[model samples]
Structure formats: C-alpha cells, structure tokens
Target: MLDQKLFRHPETLSALSDSLARRGFALEVNRISALENHRAELQSKTEQLQAKRNETSQQIGIIKAQGGDIQPLLDEVAGLGDALKIDQAQLHDVQEQLQAIYLSIPNVLDDSVPDGDSEDDNVESHRWGELRHFEFTPKAHPDLDKIGLDFESAAKISGARFAVLKGGLARLHRAIAQFMLDVQTQYHGYTEVYVPYLVSGEAMRGTGQLPKFEADLFKIEGKVAGDQDFYLIPTSEVPVTNLARDSIFDEQDLPQKYVAQTPCFRSEAGSHGRDVRGLIRQHQFEKVELIQFTKPEDSFDALESMREHAEAILQKLKLPYRVVTLCSGDIGFSASKTYDLEVWLPGQGQYREISSVSNTLDFQARRMKARYKNKQTGKTAFIHTLNGSGLAVGRTLVAIIENYQEADGSITVPEALRPYMNGMERIQL
Candidate 1:
C-alpha cells in the first residue's frame, strides 16, 4: 500500500502517478483523491455533530441543576444522534473505499529501475562462465526422460506439469537442495529456518501476495471452526519474511539473514501454454529461499550482496549464467528493484531464469508493520525487506542433466556434487 499522505496531496499523488506511468502501470489518481476528500468532509461533519450534542447536554445539566424545564435541551441533544449515526456510516464507507484503493496500488519503482515495459527491455548486468560447447546434438529433458526422470507416472498420479524422479535423479535433486542450503547458511552467514508450508491469509496479505495474485496461488480451506483462510506457500519467501510482521526489533537486529528450503506450490494459471512439455514449469517445485531484514540506509547495498549470494550457487555448480536488471515494468509486485539470474541450459539452447534476487525496500515492511528502532535517532521506522531464490533446486537439476549429458546417454556428475552422491562418478542407463 502507498503512503496515505500521498493521496491527501493532489500534487504528490500526480507526481506518483506520473512516476508509475514510466513503469507502464496506471494509478487511479482522481478516484483516490475524491475518496479522501469525501472522507475528510464526513469526518468534519461527524466532529461538528458531536460538539453540538455535547454543548446541548451541558445546557440540559444546567437547567436540571436550577430545577427548570430541560426537555428542550434534552430533545435537542437527542435529535443530533440520528444525524451523527448517518455521518458516521458515511465516514466508514469513505474510509473503506480509500483503503481498497490503497491496497490495490502497487509499490512505486525506485529511480534506479530502468525505464522499460517488458522483460525484453531488461538490461544484462554481467555474465559468469562460458556456455559449454556440445559435440553431439543435445536432447531436451523430456526427450531424455527415462528411468530417473519420469513424467508419465507423475501425470498419472497428479496431472500435467508434474514430474517423478527415481534413483539417481531423485537423489541428485535432493543433493542440489542440500548443497544450496549448506552454502547459504554456512558460507553466506544466513540462519537456516523451517517455516510452515501453509500460511494464514493475513500472512499472505502481509507479504503482498493477497488482494492480488491470489489466482496464482494454491489456497487451502480451513477445516476447523474460527479458522481463517489458508494457502499453500508459493515460496518459502512468504513464510520467512512474514516472521517480521508486527515486530519491533532492536537496531542490532537490523541485518537478519535467513535461508530455507521448501517445496513451493504455484497454480501456473497465467502460464497455461508456456513450458507445457518440460520440467521448466511445474505446479510443485523446490527452492532454497533467502530473506533479509536490513536498516533502510543499507538496503540497496544489501541487494547487491544478496544477488552475489545467489550467483555463488550457479558459480559453485560450474554452471554458466547471466544476471539481468529487471526493468521497472518487469519487477515483482513488491520489489522496488530486482535482478534475475538466468542459467545456461544446453537442452533448451538458451538461458532460463534460475533465481531472482529482489530488494523491496520498505514496501513490504510497511504492509506488515515490520519495524525497528533506530538508536541514534531514538525513533522507529519500517525495516527494509529482501528475498530471493538462492537457487531453484529443480532448475539446477535440469541444468546439470543437460549440461553434463554425455553422447553415450549417461550423465556425468559435476565434481562438486560427486561427494553428495557418495562419490558416484556417473549415472548410466
């Protein structure tokens, strides 16, 4: 939600709308202003009615003390009650309208975000490693599917966009997640956390996932009485970041880094026809999530650091990848700025997104009321929140399968993952 003060000032609201236009988003400036104006008028009228009623009640008390007729004063006070009720109801309606408008507004892009309208306009910041040259023709994951990668069985059990791995491939997928969790927690100084797979609607709203984008989520009905709406988490980012909701932390807790590995569930509603045949898109997938809470002044620098942390996973796997700065229009709903790490996939003959690192500044914190007290200023302020996929374990597995595929149809285990595989050198049919 945007700062309410922006709606009160037409000039500020106009400037904000213009800024959003650069990102190819529109803000209902006039409608929001009208609601705010109506709310102010209703509030003023309600206060005036209360003041008049209070004055009339005092006159009635004076007449009663003098043993004089006080019915006129009493009736006058009673007459204001109906009018006050009407004003109060109108005020409530106006307030609700303003709140709805606020909730619908997306976060404003930071000035640093490039002016663009789509992913094609995104700018590549850097590249890591070189794309491996293949002597023999490479096969896509679906074509190479066999004993280990089985989509046929997954479809029978669940539906499309699901996969079942057996033996070496399943083990390899688990190893990828373990390795990522280890690297992020042990080397990158992030604390490992285990979060709930199902969260409340409040948690979803706190993280800016509800009120919009609900169709992309897998929602679960609460079975018990008095239970609120529950939804399976699309990413561990939701559960981990919501830990700071309604919290007031000490300045020393300004930089809290957390990591978690979880099976993310998404509906893939908007991407129906895309990646329909491969493991590229799935209803359920695994990811190592990274989240951070930092002081406002240090967040941008933290964004760069977090991006590097995600990049480290690709580099360690010896997989070639590139980092791109997401243009304003392509950035996530809550992120003010974002960088996506796209890894080379020989099977696809292109780079595909493997991770996305984002710094939401205070946008998410404001929504969650997650804040910290500054010792220097002795004032409280919203904390900056950030989250990223240290690496999507499924995509990493796909990259290793394609990039490490041999002409003989066997897949060579990357040296780094060999230890996790118990020194297994390769997987052969």
Candidate 2:
C-alpha cells in the first residue's frame, strides 16, 4: 500500500504517475484526484455538522437550567444529528473508493528495471554449465511413464494437469524436497518453518495474492454452514511472510530469514492449453520457499543473496541453467524487481523456470504493516520483504529425470541426492 498522500500530494503524484506508466500500468490520476477532493469536502462537512450538533445540545442544557422553553433547541439538535449522519456516510463511501483504487495499483518499478512488455523481452543475466548432449533422442518426463510417474491414475483421480508418483519416483520426489530444505536452512542461513497450508483472506491480501489474483487461488469454504473460510495457500510465502504482518521488530532483528516446504495449490485459472501435458504447470506442486525481511537499505543485496541460494541448489545438482532479469512488465504483482532461474531440460530441449527470486522492497511490507523501529532515529519504517522458490521441487525432479536418464531407461541419482536416496544409485522399472 502506498502512503495515501501519493494520490493527492502535489509534489509526489506526478512522479508516481510517471513511474507507474513506465511499468505499463495506468494510474487513474484524475479520478483519484477528484475522489480525494470529494473526500476532503465531505469530511469537512461532517466535522462541521458534528460541531453544530454538540453546540446545540449545550444550548439546550442552558435553556433547561434557566427554566426556559427548550423544545426549539431540541428540534435543532435533532436536525443536526440527521445531517451529520448523512455527511458521515458520504465521507465513508468516498474513503472506501479511494482505498479500492490504492489497493489495485501495482508498485512503481525501480529505476534499474529494464523497460519491456513480456517474458520474451526479459534480459539474460548469465548462463551456467552446458546443455547436456544426449546419445539418443531424449524423452520428456511425461514420456518416461514407468518407474512410477503415472498420469493415467492421476487423471482418473483428479482430472487433467495432475500426476501421481509412486514407488521409487515418489521417494525421489520426497528426497528433492528434503534436500532443498537442508540446503536452505543449513547452508543458506534460513530458519526452517512449518506453516499452515490454509490461511485467512487477509494473509493472501498481505502477500499481494488477493483482490487481484483471487481467481488463481483455491478458496475453501467452511465445512459447516454459513461459514466464511480460508484459502488454500498458493505458496508458503503467503503464510510465512504473514508471520511478520502487523508486527514491529527491533532493529537488531533487522534481517529475518525463513524457509518452508509446502504443497502449493493453484487454480491456474487463466492458463489454458499452456504447459498442459506435464508437471511444468500443475494444479498442485511442492516447493521449498525462501522469504526474508530486511531493512530497506539492505533489500537489493538480500535479493542477490537469495537468488544465489536458489542457484546453489541447481549448481550442486549439476543442472545446466540460466538466470534472467524479469522485465518490468513481466515481474510479479508484488515485486518491484525479479530474477528467474530457468533450468535446462534435455527432454524438452529448452530451459524452463525453476525458481523466481524477487525483492518487493517495501511494497508488501506496507500492505502487511510489517515494520522495524530504527534505533538511531527513534522512528518506525516498513521493512522490505523478499521471497523465492529455493527451487520448485517438482520441476527440479523433472530436470533430473531428463538430464540424467540413461539409454537403458534408468535414472541416475544426482550424487548430492544419493544420501537422501539411501545410497540407491539409480531407479529402473
């Protein structure tokens, strides 16, 4: 949330409008300005009416004390009360309208973010390792249906865009998550957390996933009657970040780092016929999420460190990948800037995104009221928030399957994962 003054302050609104324009977001400058004007008028009217009502009541008391007729004064007070109610209600409506506009506006882009309109326009920061060369035609993860990657059973149970991993495949999936959690917590300086899979609507809004991306989420109604319920978490970032919501920490607690593994559920509402065949896009997937709360001055550095934490996972597993800086237009709603790590997939003959690390700056912090008191200034300010996929577990598994597949239809376990696999060297049907 922006400071409300941005909509009305003469010196700030123009600069804010231009910044939003650069990001391809249109700001209703005129409408917001008009609404703010009306709000001011209505609020002034309300205050005046309230004062008149109080003054009339005081006059009535004086008339009664003098043993004089008080009916006329009583009547004036009644009229004042009615007028005050109307003015107050109008003021309330105008305030709500202004708030709605504020919430819908996207964050202003950072000056360093490149101007572009889509993923194709994103700038490549760098690439790591070489794309694997295959001896035979590589099979996509879905085509290697044996060893427990079964779509048929998954479809029968839950319809399309779903899969069921069994036996060795299921074990491998679990291992990927465990390995990621270890890398994030033990090596990356993140505290491990177990967050609720379901969270309140406010939690979703705080993370910039609601009132705009609600269709992309799965909302669960209360099991009983007439109950307003919770939303299934689309990412652990929602719940974990909300931990700092409405909270103020000491400056010493400046950087709070957290990691969690959770089953994310998404409706994938607007995506139709895209990545429709495999785990590339799914209704349900597992992810190891990393979140950080840092001082405003340190946020950009924190974003770089967080991205490296994600890249370390792919590097350790020997996966080929590239990093791209998301253009202003392609960045997520809450993020001021973002870096996406796309892992090379031999089976697909392309690089697919495995993680996105973003620095939301103070955008999300303002929304959730997450703050820290600065000891030197004796003032409180919003803490900057950052989040990333320490790596999407399912996609990492897909990369491993295709990159390490043997001509004999067996899958070689990445050495880093061998211990988690109980020293099992490979999986074969």
Candidate 3:
C-alpha cells in the first residue's frame, strides 16, 4: 500500500500515477480524487453535527432547570444525532473505497530501473562462468536418459505441469535445495528458517500478493467450520517476510536476514503454452528463498548484496549464468527494483531465470505495518523489505542435467554437489 500521505496531496498522487504508468499500470487518479473530496466533506459534516447536538443538549438542561419548556431543544438534538450517524457512515464508506484503491496501486519504480515494455528491454548487468560447448547435440532434461524424470505418472496423479523424480534425479533435486540452504545460511549470514507453506489471506496481502495476483494463487478451503481459508504459498517470501508484520524493531536490529526452503505452489494462470514441456514450468516446485528487513537508507545496498548472495550459489556450482536488471514494466508489483539471474541451459540453447532478487523499499512494510524505531529520533518508520530466490531447485536440476551431460548419456555431478551426492561423480542409466 502507498503512504496515505501521498494520496492527501493531488500533485504527489498524480506524480505517483505517472510513475506507475511506466510499468503499464493504469491508476484511476480521478476516482481517487473524488473519493478523497467526498470523505473530507462527510467528515466535516459529521463533526459539525456532533458539535451542534452537544450545544443543544446543554441548552435543554439549562431550560429544564429554570422550569421553561425544553422540548424544542430536545427535538433539535435528536435530529442532529441522526444526521451525524448518517454522515459518519458515508465518511466510513468513502474511506474504505480510497483504501481499496491504494491497496491496488503498485510501488513506484526506482530511478535506476530502466524504461522498457518487456523482458527484451531489460539490461544485462554481467555474465558469470563460461557456457560449455558440447560436441554432440544437447538433450533437454525430459529427453535425458535414466534417473527417472517422469511426467506421465505425475500427470496421472495430478494433471499437467507436475513431475515425479526418481533415483539420482530426485536426489539431485534435494541436493540442490540443501546446497542452496547451506550457502545462504552459512556463507551469506542469513538465519535459516522453516516457514508455513499455507498462509492466511492477510499474510498474502501483507506481502503484496493478495488483491492483485490472486488469480495466480491456489486457495484452499478450511475443513473445519469457522476456520479461515488459507492460500498455498506461491513462494516462501510470503511467510518469511510477514515475520515482520506489525513489528517494531530497535535501531540495532536495522537489518534482519532470513533464508527459507519450501515448496512453492502457483496456478501459473495465463501461462498456458509456455515452458509446458518439462520442469521449467511446474505447478509445484521447491525454492530456497532469501528475505531481509532493513532501514530505508540501507535497502538498495542490501539489494545488491542479496543479488550477489544468489549469484554465489551458481558460481559455487560452476553453472554459467548472467544477471540482468529488470526494466520497469518487467518488475514485480511490490518491487521498486529487481535483478534476475539467468542460468545457461544447453538444452534450451539460452539462459533462463533461476533467481530474482528485489528491493521492495517500504512498499510491503507500509502494508504490513512493519516498522523500526530510530534511536536518535525516538520515532518509528516503515522498514524496507527485500526477497529473492537463492535459486529454484527444479531449475537448477534442469541446468545440471543439460549442462553436465556426457556422450554416453550419463550426467557428471557438479563438484560442489558431489559431497552431498556421497562422492558420486556420475549418474548413468
């Protein structure tokens, strides 16, 4: 949610709308303006009526004490009370309308974000590692031999966009997640956390996922009566970042870092024909997520550091990848700025996104009421929040299969993951 103060001034609100326009979001400025005006009028009327009622009541008491007729004064007071109630209700309704508009507005793009319409316009930051050249034709993960990557069984059990891995392929997927968790926690100084895969709608709203991206989510009804419905988490970002919801941290706690490993569920709505062949696009996938809460002044720097943290995992695994700064139109709703890490896939003959690190600034903090108290000023202010995928486990597994394939159809394990695989160097049929 945007700061209410921004909407209080027409110039600021217009500026915000213009900023969001760069992201292709059409903010209804005129509607908000009208609502604000009506809210102000109703509030003023309600206050005036209350004041008049109080005065009339005092007059009635005085007249009755002097033994004069006070019925007229009593009647005026009753009318004022009814009018005040009506005005108060009107005021409440307008305020709710304004809040709904604010909740739907996305974060303003950072100045550093490039202006572009889509992913094609995103600027590449840098490239890491070297893309391997294969002597034979590279096979996509689905075409790789043995190791049991089954989509047929998964489709039978749970329709399309789901997969079942067996033997070495399954272990490789687990190893990738464990390796990412260890790297983020041990090397990146992030505290390891286990978060819920199902969260409340409020928690989703707190993270800027509800109201806007609801169609892309999976909602589950509660089995017991009176229990609130829960939504399956699209990412660990929801529960991990919501840890700071309605919290006030001391100045010394300016930066809080946490990493979580969880299975993410997404409806993949509107993505009917893209990446439907393999693990590239799945209804359910595992990801190691990194989250940080920091003072406003330190968030951009934290964003860069977080991006490096994610890049380090690919570097350790020696996977060829590149980083790109997401353009305004390509960024997420809650993020002010974002960097995506795309790993090379020999099978696809191109780089695909494996991780995305974002600096949401105070966009999510304002929604969650997550704040920090300043030691010097003794005042609380919204905290900046950031989240990123350290790496997508399924995608990493895909990269390993495609990048490490041998002429004999066996897969060589990346050295970093060899220990996790019990010193096994090659996986063959």
TM-score of each: 0.95, 0.95, 0.96
Q: What lDDT tens digits, residue by residue, belong to model 3 across residues 61-158?
A: 89999999998888888888888888888899899888888888899899999999999999998998888888999998888857678899999999
For all predictions, the C-alpha RMSD in Å is: 1.8, 1.8, 1.8
Rank ordering of all candidates by lDDT, starting from the highest: 3, 2, 1
Q: Could you tell which candidate, 1 or 3, scores higher by lDDT?
A: 3
- Per-candidate total of colliding backbone pairs: 0, 0, 0
Best by lDDT: 3
Of candidate 2, the 10-residue stretch with the lowest lDDT total is 220-229
**Runs with alpha carbons beyond 4 Å of true place in candidate 2:** 55-73, 224-226
lDDT of prediction 2: 0.91
Each model's lDDT comes to: 0.89, 0.91, 0.91
> Residue by residue across 13-84, what tens digits does model 2's lDDT show?
888998888778888988988899899899888888888888889888888999999999888988988888
